[model samples]
Structure formats: structure tokens, C-alpha cells
Target: MNQVNTVVLLHTVLHCHFTSADSIENYLFEHYSASMKPRRNQNELVEIDIAMTIQTVLKVDERFQYISFYGWFEVQWRDEFLMWNETEYQGIKKISVPYQQMWVPDISMYYSEEHIHDLGVHPFVSVTSQGHVTWFPGAKYTVQCYLKVKKFPFDRQKCSIVVAAWQTTDRMQKLVPRARSVNEVKGIAENGEWEFQNFTYEENYDAEFDLTKIVYTLEFQRRYRYFLLCTIMPIVILSVLNSLTFLIPVESGERITYCLTLFLTFTVFLTLFDQTMPRNSIDVPYITVFVSFHLFLCVISTMVSILTISSKRGQECDSRDTQIVPLESQGEDLHLGEVNADGKRSGSSGKNYLRRTLKSILKEVFICKIDTVMLVMNFFFLGSSAFVLVICYIS
Candidate 1:
């Protein structure tokens, strides 16, 4: 077995060198040789610039029947320079290198899983030299895994999504992330669908500077179905009931009773409607218009009932005779009262005859006219109201 000497310099730029014949060192040298080389300085400083380009692919896992994200990254060393240390050792150095922080990539997601599926490599910071290598403890890389849904149907304020980081060891459990946030994308989610907004990073240490395995979860709710059932059904039923008020006979006491009852019923329904809706009068909603029509019908029905009662009373009055007829005695009919004036009649027979004939004819005519008028008015008003109600309801 052979032993090797290794030296590492740690700063904003990490530089390291190894002197050994180890097979692992030879492999690292061959693979990364173009990037890692001997420096020309006296202190044996070997500057190396390491950078990573990440490629992400998302696919629906046919076997698992779930969405999966696959990410691949390649770390390359560029612009390598060789130098010598004071101890006569060869080293590599560079003035500028890609920042380590930029190497960490993160993805936004919405589900929970314990283990990351198809994780290609464990998160680590690595550099290799001949048979000797140094590891940076607690150094990690983070990649954000996210899905951009084109459009989400619903209020964005109420909608939410969750991202979970998981490890391969526990496939069923979700690994929690350090932080999460959300942003609204402009001109997106406008067509009743979800739009991919950028993921917001959180201040929680759990979310900072690291690559982890993760998935995302999405959630939302809609009220179209509920509105159709709860609002439309009741309004339709109530409107139908309102129209039925016309079926009651105008003379029947039930006519007034039904109208008043329906009026109250609709009033209560309107109260409920008001509570459910915001206070706005841009245009009356269909339900509100239906309620108003029914209310109008109830009011008209009540008025008609009152007018009918008044008209019937008027007919009764007109049917009574204004003058009374005198009855004649059977045996004493020939005896007439004495007349004082030369041309005046003393008998009651003539007066009685005149009263009976004239009063009877007048009563009959007056009663007939009153009855006809009442009948015509009732028919016209009720029929007109009925027609109006029908039109409103249908409309």
C-alpha cells in the first residue's frame, strides 16, 4: 500500500492538490485533468473553476401512474492553471471561478414523499486528486423541482400548492422543505386555468442553499354547481307558486289568505337572498327579478279582492227599492179617502200603483248594471295581471 500527501486551501474559491499513486487519484486526474492542473506560483496554489449546468426533464411515470421530474447535471472545470508550492509541489489555481451558491438549483413542487425518486447522485461538494481527496462537511446542493400549470380555475387567493422534498430511502414519506412562497403570474390564470407563477423562497433555514429530492401538490374549489342548485331551484319553485295564486276564486276567502301568505313567503325568501349576495344593484339577478314579479302579483291580487267586495256591496244597495208599495184591504177597497181640493185624489190606490211600478223597474236596472260592471272589471284586471305574471316568469 502507498501513502499520499494532500493539501487543501479553503476560501471563497476552494483549491486543493494531492501527491499520490492511488488508483482513485489516477481516475480523478484522467476525468478532470483538463480542468485541474499544476500552477506556476511558488506557494503551490492550484486554482480550479468548477461549474454545473443542470438539465431537467419531467415525465408522467407510466408504471407509478404519477408525475415525476428527472434532473441531470454535469460539473465541468474550465481555465485551469498550474503552479508550484514553496515545498516544491505542483498545484492548480485560478483567479475567477463560478460561485458555489449559483451551483445550487431548486425546484418548486406540491406533494410529499419521503424519498426522492430516481435521484442520480447524493448532494455533495467534491474535488479529487491522485489517491487523495478532501470532502467539505455539511456542504450541500439544492435543486428546485416545480410544475407550471397553465391555468388554474378559481380564485388565486384561495388556491394553494405545496412542495415536498423526499429521499429515496423512504418513498412513502415526504421530506419537508426549509421554505415556501407563492406569486401571481400576470396575464396567466385568466382563462379559467392555472398559470405557473414563480416559486417564492422562504427565510426558513430549511429552504436555503441546497439540492434535495421533492414533489409538488395542488388544491382548489369552485361554486358553480352549488349556485345552480341552491339559488336557481328555489327561485324557480317560488315563482311557480306565485303564479298559482290566480287559481283561487275571487269570492272565496282563501283568495286573500293565499295572496298574503305567498307575499310573506317571498319576503322571507328575499331576505335570505340578500344575505347570500353582496350588496350590488348593477342589474337585478334572475332570482331577484323573479321574486319582484311574484311580489307584484300578490299585491295586485289583494287589490282585486278589495275591489270585488266593494262592488258586491254596491250591487246589494242598488237592488233594494227606494219606495215601498202599500197593501190594499180586500173588503174596504171601495172606500177612498176624501179629497179636499177640486182635482186632488183622496185614495191611496193610485199612489201605491205608481210607486210599485216605477221603483221595481229602477231597482232591476240598477242591479243588472252593477253586476255586469263588477264582473267585467274582475275578469279584466285578473286576466291582465295573469298575463303579465306569465310574461315575467317566462322571461
Candidate 2:
């Protein structure tokens, strides 16, 4: 048997020791001017690709008509000025430089009404041997968008983050597909009030300005659990409670008090709810209507209670007036009539009293029947309203 020995040697190269920082700086300074773009000519279309990942939804201000969000923005383009031969620099493939030294394109959010906040957490500049320049800007954008809030807490909203060149139009610049994977892009710190549904990308053209715009539309559905537990459920309960006033006996005088207290409570809740929303009169919110309906029901119940009290007082006054005449006749008979006349007058007085008593009892029975009918009607209204509201919320 023969034994064989095999050996392999691996050689590693170190280029950082030989390549001086001054030489790289000098090359960059000579090749790139402060005002020059990476393109060869003014008409040359410099293509840039944008890839962004949503980090958090800071705030969606309906009152101010703006949405604040944090995202990671990566802009990539080929820089002919930053390229160097790899073989000439002892296999040195890349180098880092200050961001301020390069002439970055002025890509901005077209719909942004305010300045974007950039969190300088990472290095702002990158250079590669193949002449690729990348800028990773921490994008904290506050974009202005119109929000339709007719449904409010139960509303789904579509918002956009539009990106375009500030001074350069589509004739001079173009946007291409992103090189990085976009599947990982998502809302990191989600807002408790809203749930991220999905998002889409679209390219829009402005005919008047001849500009190409890139848009990222974010669709969000509001999380109604908070409002349901805090505002909506309480208002519904108050509505039912107010409607219960009709079940109370109007003569108790407490019916009006109960309804009035409930109305005031509903008003307090309404005020609080209003404070959380924008005060636009263009479209009234469903929540506002619901609260107002409860208040209206309370008012109607109070009026009914007042009417009942008035009716009772009027009946008492009539009874008193009827008794006065009978008493007077009885007194006059005792003074001026013989036994036969007195006996006849007493009988006649008794018959008239019985007739009036029967009439008063009948009137009271009729009034109670009306009260019952009203109570039934009010309860039905309350039930239907609650059912409709629940359907709207769930759907």
C-alpha cells in the first residue's frame, strides 16, 4: 500500500495598508465638481430607483389634514464619477466618503406640505467599485392628504406618499424598479387606532407639468374596538335608558327628571366625542347623529311627562269646581226646603255626583291608554335605532 500526502495553501491580500486616504480623496475631488451631476449631458435621463420600508405611523392628524410616518428610504443610482479600477488599487473594491461631498439628486415628496425630518442614525454615504452610489435617508415624512371622515371611527382611509423630482421632470430623469426586496416593507409600530390593511404602487403622469410621479397608496382600516368600548356603547346605553322614561308613570314627576339627567349626560358624552374629531360641517358624522337622536328622545319624553302632570292638575281643578256647586245646593236645601223637597234634592245631587265621577274615571282610563301607546311606540323606536347602529358598525 502507498500513502499519498496533499497540501493546499490559501493566500489573503490586505489592500487597506497600501491605499492612502489622501489618494482616494484627491481622485474624488478631481473627478467630481460640486455642481456637476452624475449624468453626461443635461438631456441625459438619470435613472433612480426608490425602495422604502414603513417603520411607524407617528400620527394621522385629520384636523390638520396630514399624516406623519417614519420610513427607511433608499435611493440608488450609478455614479460614473466615483468609479475606480479594482486592479490598480491592490484589489481595493470600495471606499467610504462624506455624503456632503457628492451631488445627490433632489428627490422629494411632491405632496408633502412640510419639511421631512431625517434621523441621522446611519452613515449617509456609500461608494462601490462598480460606480454605484446609495443613499439611505431616514425618512420621517408628514404628508398632506384629504381624509373623508363621514364614518369616522369606523371609516377606512386611503393615503398616499408621492415621490418626484423637485426640479427635474420625466424628460430629464426616470424612476425604475427597486433593487431591494419590498416584501419586508411594512408598518412596524402600528397605531392602536388604525389597522394596516395593505398598500399599492402606482405611477402617475401630470400632463400640465409633464412630470412622472411615483405614488405609494397605503390603505388602512380604523380599529373601532376602542371607540365602541368608550364612546359608542355608552351612548347606546344612554339612549335605551332615556327611552325607559316613557315606562315610568307620568304622575310620579320623576319621569321628567330622569330624562333630563340622561339628556345632560348624553350631551357631556357628545362634547367629549367632538373633541376627538375634526369640526367640519361639510358632512355630519354618524356618531353625532346617534348622540343627537338620544337627546331628542329624552326631550320628547320630558315633554310627555310635563303634559301628563298638566292633565292631572286640570282634572283636579275640574273636580273641585264640580263639588262646589253640589255643596252649595245641599246647604241651600237644608235652610229652605221641607222634608219631601229636601229628600228629592238629596237624591238629585247624588245622581249628578255619580255621573260626574263616572265621566272623570272614563277620561283617566283614556289618558292611561294613550300613555301606554306612546310608551310602546318609543320603545320600538329605541330598539330599531339601536339595531340599525349595530348593523352599521359591524358592517
True-vs-predicted CA distance for residue 291, candidate 1, Å: 1.0
- lDDT string for model 2 (187-303, tens) is 457678888877667788887777777788888888989887987788777877776676787667687778779988988987876776677787567778788887887788777
Q: What are the lDDT scores of the predictions, listed in order? A: 0.39, 0.71
Q: Estimated TM-score per prediction?
A: 0.31, 0.80
Candidate 1 lDDT, 1-395, residue by residue in tens: 12222222232123233332123234333434332222223234222211111122233221222333332323232112212132322343212212231122222233324222322344443332221212121211232223221111122212222332332122212233333132323312332222333323222223343323332222222323554576556655655665565555545657677768878988987787566443445433455655666677668766766665555565456445233334445675533233333534445565555654586566556544543554455455445655654565455
Q: Lowest summed lDDT over 10 consecutive residues: which window, candidate 1?
A: 149-158
Model 2 score (lDDT): 0.71
| Residue 355 miss distance in model 1 (angstroms) | 18
